[model samples]
Target: MSDKNDSATVLPEVTFSTFVLSLASSALVHLGEVPNPETGNTSRNEALARNAIDVLTMLDDKTRNGLTPEESKLMRDVLYELRMKFVARS
Candidate 1:
């Protein structure tokens, strides 16, 4: 018989912070800052990256004061880094 505890193990639940990070990572990949894991290729798509960054910025603004400290910082840092990369690529 299997242990009941084995069935209790669960994957990490997705949160706002994780969702934001996911988008930031995608933008980085599109900007060629990070390589595509599956294709082993880096491609620059400033238009798409910029759009993703804009979406993040809008989310941050809309969710201001609602996020936990860590969540807020993560979003801010990701946005800042992505913006810098976008400018450097431009």
Candidate 2:
């Protein structure tokens, strides 16, 4: 049996939202909207940012009718925010 007080040992559960958020954050970095964690500088790369956004769009299409309502909304919101940011930064 596991102990009740194991919060320190337990890791956060991975979910679709977390995955999408990770990609979105990376895309923002590529678009120079966020700084590169390693370099402490923002490097604008539209190609990479667009690619990431495309990947997310593909995921949205492929996962249609498969995600919960909340999950679907989160994915849409993230994509919208990323796209808008990409456009503004371009």
Candidate 3:
């Protein structure tokens, strides 16, 4: 007999490679708005732009140490795009 309160617990190993892969995947989905089909429409485009900004902000904070020079340049480019979109909306 097992206690009802006892629950099975599972934990996956965390590694640098896994972390980087997860970050990259998340960044892609947010930047591309993969799950939101109306992302490019005028009504939803602001939301998509905001999402991209948020993702870039998070990546800049989390992966500062892990990013290569090329990755940093790409991040900067994305940031610039986000800024331009924000300004355009104003």
Candidate 4:
């Protein structure tokens, strides 16, 4: 039998879309829209949420015309959804 960590989980592949989604997820957590996976609690912190959203926006701007269509759309959609949540929480 091989000695290996059977409980080790595989990580998701890194891609522009996945990166965008991760950032959006963080924004959602900060907005108290999604529970923190680590704590199983939701709490609003507009500053952190806005910072995450802003970082996403900046990433999109800096990567314009450099991403695949799907990636671009993913970024746009994630930003839109996060923005709406941020607004609602405000």
lDDT ranking from best to worst? Answer: 2, 1, 4, 3
Task: Please list all clashing residue pairs in model 2, or write none if there are none.
Answer: none
- The C-alpha TM-scores of every prediction are 0.82, 0.83, 0.48, 0.89
Best by TM-score: 4
Where does candidate 1 stray beyond 4 Å?
A: 1-12
lDDT of 1 by residue, 8-88 (tens): 876556889779988998899999989988898999998899999999999999999899999889988999999999999
> What is the C-alpha local distance difference test score of each model?
0.90, 0.91, 0.57, 0.90
Q: For candidate 2, write residues 21-78 as lDDT tens digits.
A: 8899899999998899999997899999999999999999999899999999999999
Candidate 4 C-alpha lDDT tens digits along 1-90: 434785476668888777888988899899998899999998989999999999999999999989989888888889898888889889
Candidate 3 worst ten-residue window by lDDT: 35-44
Query: Residue 31: error of model 1 in Å?
Result: 0.6
Off by over 4 Å in 4: 1-7
When 1 and 2 are scored with lDDT, the better candidate is 2
Q: List the residue pairs that clash in candidate 4.
A: none
- Which scores greater on TM-score, model 1 or model 3? 1
Poorest 10 consecutive residues of model 4 by lDDT?
1-10
At residue 62, give the lDDT of candidate 4: 99
Candidate 3 lDDT by residue in tens digits, 1-90: 556666575445675444544444444444443444445422334565566567667877889888888777666666676566566564
